[model samples]
Structure formats: C-alpha cells, structure tokens
Target: MDGSVMQDTDLAVLLHQVQHRTASPEIVSSDCSASPPAVLPKRVAAAFASTDGDSDSGGDSLLRPKKLRKPTDSGGDSLLRPKKLRKPTYAARKEEIAALLEEHRLLQARLELLRQNVGIPTSYDHDTLEAAQRQQRAMEEALRLQQFALGNTQSLFSKHMNALEPNPLKTYIHLTTDAVERRNTLLSIRREKLHRCYQFVHERLHHIPETSPYHVEERYVNAKGDRIISRFERLLFPGVQDVKQVFNALLFYLTNMEISISETLGHVTVRDDIDAVETRVSNHRVVSSTSYGIELELNAVHCYEYYEKFEEMGGQEFAME
Candidate 1:
C-alpha cells in the first residue's frame, strides 16, 4: 500500500507541471533568423484554427488586391476599328441658321419690291398689240431696205471704176515687141508731148492774149534791176495751168476714148502705153471739146432684159429720178 501511494503522488506532480505550462503565455521571438523558432503547442495550432471567415488566421491578409490586368492589343485589329463620333450641339450653329433665315426673308422682300416696280401694261388687247408691233417692224424693215439700196448704188460706181483697172500681165502679153523697148519708145513720145504742150501754153499766154484767159507780163522792176518775170493773171474761171497738171487732165480725158488726133498721129504698139503722143493728144482733145460746149452723143441698140430683171428685184429704188 505504501508503494502504491508514492506512485500516485508522482503522477499528480506531472499533471500540475503540464497545467502550469499551458496557462503561461509563450514568449516567441519576432526575429526568427538568428535563433530557431520556439516550438508552438501542437495541440492548439493551425489545425485547430477556423479557416472559414477569419482572414487574419492565415497568409490571406498579406496578399495584395490583384489589379485587373488590362486586355492586351491583339495586333492591327484595334487600329481598324471605326472611332466613335462626338454628338454635335444645335446651340453652337443656332446663330448661323438664324442669319440665313433673316437673309432669306430680306431677299424675299427685295424680290417683291422688284416685281411691283416693273409695271407692265396689261390693259391692251394682245392681238391689237401684236398687229401694231408687226406694222412697226415692217416700217423699220422698209427703211433698212432703202438704206441698203442706197449703199449698193454707191458701191456700183466703185465697182465700175474697179472694172476700168488694167492688168499688167494682159498688157505685156498683148505687146509683140520686147516690153522694155516699147516702154522706152512710149517714154520718149510722152516727154516730147509734154514739152510741146508747155510751149503751146507759154506761147498762147503771151502771143495769143485774146484766146487765153491769162495775161503775162515780160518786164517787172524789183530791188534788182529789170526782172523778166512772167506775171500771169486769170481773167476767167480758176483753172490749173501747170504742164504736169494739164498733162494728167489730158490723159484722164483721153484714156477711155475710141478716137483722138494723138492716137492717129502716134505710132503706138500697146494701147496701155500712156507715154505715146497719140494717147497724150487724144486726152487733150477731149478736154478741149468739153471746154467748148460739145455734147457727147451716144448711139447704141437697147437690150433692156437685164435692166428689167434688176428693176423687178427692187433695184428701181436705187434709180435717180
């Protein structure tokens, strides 16, 4: 029995030591790098801790809230997407639209004013006005036709003059002799005719004083001793008396004539040769005849077929009364 009591006391001492260790809090070092970690009581460890709601019991609290990683751009697909357009505000363009509307109103008012100002006569009968306009147009057309007829009459004279122009090639072809030789002979004859005409005029002015209208004085006194000055005074009509002037007048008169004394006397080859004595004198004869009141007679057969046709076509309007 004594031996049993000593064993029970020993057992009670071991139970008390265990209770004391459990009751006292363990002093664990936070610096666990230098010393080994103090052993924890395996009885009240993680296995016994609640894992359902307590966030501080495990390493869950230390983990950061993972930022949601943005989706990466897959290649050119992002660039190909159409950009969304921003909505436009009506307030921003309201003033411009108002200005346009105001302009339209002003334009409408101007158009109305213009329409009122142009006062067209609406009282006249349309057919009467049309007939009056037609009569006025006909009168205007008649006046235009009269003016055209007058213009054509004036142009007819010019056309006749143009027809009288000589062709040099035709004249050359007509001459049988060398053109240069004929020209030289014609020039000599012209010079002689001009000298003779000048002498005749000079003699007539001094010798035949009664026939000539001009009276010439042979003697005149000036600062220098007695000058033999030919002072010619015209007692009749005013006329050119110069040799060159008289020569031109004679040629103009004789150029179109069929017969003349100069032509009969002059041994001329080409009819176009104005320097021939016949041509020069023929022109002079015409002038002399015209001056002496000789009437030019015209004797020709009448063929009025073309003239009748011309008169039918309104040419009678251009005829002199």
Candidate 2:
C-alpha cells in the first residue's frame, strides 16, 4: 500500500513539473462540474472539458486547407495568383535607357543611309559632266585659246623683283614675250661680252638678274669658328649694294640705246657705255668688279683695268650673248 501511494505521488509530481503553471491544489478545478468537449479522446474527457472550448473546438479548424488559383482564374484565391500584366521595375538606371536610345537612333540613321545608297544616283557621272560641258559651250565660246602678254623687263624687274619678299626658297620662272624683253636680251648678250667675270662686268653676284637666289650662299666662320648669316645689316651687304645697282643701271641704259653714227658712219651706239668697252675704252670706263661699278661710274675720270687680271686667272671667254 505504501509503494503504490509513493508511485502515485511521484507520477503527480512529474506531471506537475512538465506543465509550466504551479501544481498547487488551489489551481486544480473539479472538471465534473464543467461542460463536455466538442471532439476529443474520452480518456482525457475531464482534461478536454477543463480546456477553454473556444481554442480547439471545431473539426474543420484542425485541417484548414489553403486555396490555390490558376493563372486563367480571377475569382477565389486570386490575391496569390500569377499576374497577367507585367509591372514596371524602378531598378533600371538612367544611363542604361540613354545608351539604348542612342544605339536605336544610330541604327535608324544607318538604315536611312543604306536605303538612300541603294536608290540615289550620283551627279558626277560622265553623261552629267558632258551635259554640263555642252551647256557651257552653247552659253559661252565653243573654242578656247590661251593668249599670253609680256611686260617690260625693266619695269617688271624693278616692280616685282623683291628677293626678301619671296624668301629665297621660292620658285621663280621668268618667261616674257615683249619688245622690251627682246631688247633686254640683246643688251644682256652685249654685256656678257664685256667680261663681267673679271670685275669688268657684273662685279657683284647680285648684279646678275637671277643672282639673288642663284648666287651661292657663302658661309663665313667667325674668329670663334661659328657660321654667321650673310645680311645687309652687317658690313658685307653695304659693300656689295653698289655692285648690284650698277648692273641694274647698266641694263636700263643699254636696252634703250640709240644707234648713233660718227662722221665715219660707223655702227656707233649712243648708249652710256654701249660702245665704250668694245671700242677704245677710256681707262675711266672700266670697272674693278661689280662691287665697285657704282664708284667707278661716279668717279669715271680714273677707272682702272679690272678685266686683264681676271682674264689671266684661267678666265672664261667673255659673253657676247
């Protein structure tokens, strides 16, 4: 009897400890006085009767089923349905949209150009060019001929020949067709015979008509053996200026010479120095070099023999062009 009582007491203590609520006698109510359960085991009829009926009473509440809706359906359970209309996502960045638009625009432009390329005809074809030519000929002259006029050499040389302006590196072509040019040529031929090579004719290199660029550029090394530029601002240019001027002045006078005759009726030229060199030239008429021509002409009373020394120095035959 004592072991059975002890076992029952331990069982009651174990059941009480499993529940969180206190196992005090005051909390235990008499289930016989309570109402019966809705649906439960009969062995625990008192416990079910003791349970609050509102909590686990209905059989339908225990196996409650969730409703499912098909994609085509729009009635019950539609709130959990797959959407027919696609929603716009706000996560796309601004740069992505702009890039797509730019690509689309470029594609459209390329398509237009391709369409034009297939259909459009060019106006530069031979037929179009020939038509233009025909029209131009009918409107204007049918035949075209090129004509050339020549200007006076003295005037052209003085007016147009500026060495500094063309910068020496420029290309120059002197093609003239005129009476003055012809006369200048004759004068040049005559002067060449005067042996300008020996300081008797063109003493300065620039005295030659094309000599500005034609003359060799002399490289002068200083005491320090450094190359220097040859220019008029330095002493060399001043020394050479007169020689160039004399050539010009001689050309001017010779090209316009008069065919004067003496009592003997010789073919005596009345140029300033036309017959002076070829004839019995006065000592005063000769030039030391193109460099000293101006000084010689100015002091014509005492000009020296310049050509003899040059003639001795393996000199070339004088020009009689």
Question: What lDDT does the true structure give each of the candidates?
Answer: 0.44, 0.42
Flag regions of model 2 displaced more than 4 Å.
Answer: 1-90, 93-99, 108-297, 300-321
User: Which residue pairs overlap in candidate 2's backbone?
Assistant: 192-319, 193-319, 196-201, 199-289, 203-289, 203-290, 204-290
**Cα distance off (Å), candidate 2, residue 208:** 11
lDDT of 1: 0.44
TM-score of each: 0.18, 0.20
**TM-score of predicted structure 2:** 0.20
lDDT of 1 by residue, 221-307 (tens): 433453334344644435755334543554454454444533653322123322333332221122222334553433211110112
Which 10-residue span in candidate 1 carries the lowest summed lDDT? Answer: 299-308
Top candidate (lDDT): 1
